[model samples]
Target: MSETIALSFEEIPYDWRVPGTYVEVRPSYTNLGVLGFPARALLIGQQLAAGTATPATPYRITRLDQAKRLFGAGSVAAAMAEAFLAANTTSDLTMIGLADPGDGVAASGSLTLSGTPGASGVLALYIAGRRVPVTVAAGAALNDIAAAIRAAIAADPDLPVTASGTLATVTLTAKHAGAVGNQIDVRLNRLPGEATPPGLAVAITPLSGGAGAPDVGAALAAIAAEWYTDIAVAWTDSANLLALTSELAARYAAMGRLDAHAYAGLAGSFGQLAAAGAALNSPHLTLIGARASPSPPWAWAAALCGVATFHLANDPARQLRSLALPGIAAPAQADRFTPTEQDLLLRDGISTFDVARDGAVRLSRVITTYQTSPLAVEDTAWLDVMVPKTLSRIRYDWSGYVSLTYARHKLADDGSPAAEHAEAVVTPRQMHGAWAARCKLYERQGWIEDAERTVAESVFQRSASDRNRLEARQKVRVIGNLMVLAAMLQFEA
Candidate 1:
């Protein structure tokens, strides 16, 4: 016996492991990996300087000045501001704006003033929300006044126009390239002459340009590469909305990455919104229409998008009701929908807002475009009944959490062939457990319901024929918000 000494050796497991390895299971999903973490919004519109912005690139706009610089101080910038203000009302927001090189013509207008000033006076001129006041000497000629006005307008750095004209007429060229320039109004007040103030006349010449066909495609391409929860096309025209819906649906189906919901508004009556929604018939799109009166369609869309983004970024599970729109005014009572009008809107998949007693505008019911489906049989159809913003956030959170969690873990494929197959199957089961746990967390937080049953019905399987492949299915029960109540009062003696 050669010593017959039994030597003990430390047994080390070949499997990779760290002494304190820990996986953090988030209670909720978040878009932290995106360029702009919480308040990211994509705004598409016609930019004054479309050439300066790169096509199909998500540009982060943190300040109004940055938006002005990228888009030029024009209608596009104004739309961006509307969106930014609406989003920032609840929380700080960052807008990613894409300037659409639209086909519509830029509008040009000229104001011609007749007659000379009889006495020294002050005249105020309003153009595109910018006001300029001119002081005329007692004996100043009409042409001289026009020249002074043009010079003054040109001197102001804030006006989005280049002024040019002769003595009696002033020509204002829009800095932005779109039909939005057509909205510019020029008002003259505090004139020098007593006899009708020599009447100021205006002539508007429309700009002819490219059809915005390329714009939606470009925006969708850019959005496909990034992460965003809310998208608003600043234009409210039917053609733009149609193109946007088509592009968004196609891109989302193809990539199936993040869920990007589009917010839009119709400037027509309740019937119009209903018709549009029925024609579109898409769950991914949310159409808002004012029943109280005709409202600024773009502003409504922007405000809704801002609200949706804020809620999703902060807490993806909350509803967007009773949230006050800071800059939005309440629609007129005449414009508000009657009970019958509300029924039509709900049936047609349109969402409307309500004006609170305090004059604050609040979201009534955010609906989706899945209106015609049989509500009794299709659970998905019922999804349209809840707030669209809330539903979108839930879907995004669950999908993102599942994707990120699976991507982080590596499967073991280096054992005996039987062992490898077993390990592969085990990995998915482990993943399924983690995913189920996440769903449970949402249930605990009132974001979802019936987590256990949903997980059991969900599929998690590795292909028996292919050891490397794994497939999974996840079902979720989204918890709805309390939007309505019914009670019967009993009189006691």
Candidate 2:
């Protein structure tokens, strides 16, 4: 005999299932680097204040005094000003700066005054790029002439030096410390009168005492263990560039990050700069060079860094092209290259500047051929600036998606009906679907070529031996910038 239980007609049902779409969280990119500073900053080497581990937070600097404290007042300060101006030409931009507790060695020199002035005479002296004029009254004493010269030199802050003197000689001391002070040239114009100006016999001392190399190693170390999209030093020295490139590559490898790029300036003939770039043998480093000009070569490098940072930050997946650099001028040199010579430079992996039709100085195109070799066949398309950047962005995006998807789903390894259903959510098919979705976004934005076969080929797969492991491979096609054009016209009767 079995006992039967009666159930109520009305009943309530409860749902015990997880719901909603499990979307992934994406990380934003950070663009920052050291772009400008002067010869003085190099002399300071690398020093961080005690108890401080990293540079100050990245920000825009509006005052010269602030720049002077970080980079020192001189060519470095001027470079920063130019970078900021060019970067903010079309839109407002800010740059990151490093602070050091180091000091520079001020250069010192002196000029001796000889011959006396019979009647009113003029004495002219040139320092750096500024001219100082001292007027002597009839029968003026040497002390009076020295005083006038000191006042004139002191009035101009750009000279980077202060003037002091005794009764017959004037001494000039660099206002800032560094080896760059040694390059200052002093010229005393030849005067016409019995009271002649300082001649060859006048005896002028060249400025000296500047010392120290840029402490890039320390600066990089201070930035905290993180990823930086760009790292630039307003220096064009070969040794410095080499150090920076090596460090950047090693850091990227260790951290498993591939977004860092290094920029450097070199001063010489086109061939010389090209040779330097080849010797570097790094795709991570981009070299910009200009012919020897009166203006510092590093100035152009700083401007390029600023422009590159702005473009990369605003559009990480696009190429930088045809952007106008207002107030920026091409390097003026005595040995300007001919059209053929300029073409040769481009062939040797050097980027050139030109005056655009709109009257602005702009970059013609950006390229990187540091990996060219006879052993392996590679196309010039690999050297395009946007190609690698876009590829990196895609890789990062795909990686983020996979990590997030795995974190939210848990499935049993046992081959059971329930386990199989749960695994379906993250199976190879699902991964392919996610990849195709991302590719569609890229294609719609015109960054890559879109095709059904291409999307199908980019699917992800799981390794047969390792149930916990998955692999994905994708080929990205990039649209390059239009750099050159050729056309022919025909007339027929």
lDDT to native, each model: 0.60, 0.55
* Model 2 alpha-carbon drift over 4 Å, by segment: 1-64, 75-78, 89-153, 156-212, 251-255, 317-319, 326-329, 333-335, 356-360, 369-381, 403-406, 410-420, 451-453, 491-493
* Residue 303, candidate 1: alpha-carbon lDDT: 75
Please give the lDDT score at residue 183 for candidate 2.
46
Give the Cα error of residue 455 in candidate 1, in Å: 2.7
The sequence of per-residue lDDT tens digits that candidate 2 reaches over residues 1-493 is: 7544332111222342566544444432222121121111111122122212134344344554554454445444444555545454443333343433256566789988777666665666766534567677766677777788888887775555689878878898855455545545566552223333333125578677665444455555544465556554655455666677677667556265646666655557767876765565555666666663323344555566667766765555565667755545444334455567666665566666665555366776666535565455434654655665566556656666656455645433334444454432356665666667767766765667754567777756777788777666776677555666788888896
TM-score list, all predictions: 0.67, 0.67
Per-residue lDDT of 1-493 in model 1, one digit per residue for the tens? 4433322222444454868554443432332332123446676655554435554556666566666666666545455555556556554444444553555555577777765566666676655334577777776777887898898897875565668988787888766556545434444442234222333333334322313323466666655666666776666556766777676566456266555677776655666767776675666678887642322455577778777777656655566777765656555566677878876787777876778777667887777766445443334443442444445555565566656544444453323333343322236666677667777776776767888999899887677788667677778877766767989999998
Worst 10 residues of 2 by lDDT: 35-44
Measured with C-alpha atoms, the lDDT of residue 161 in candidate 2 is 67
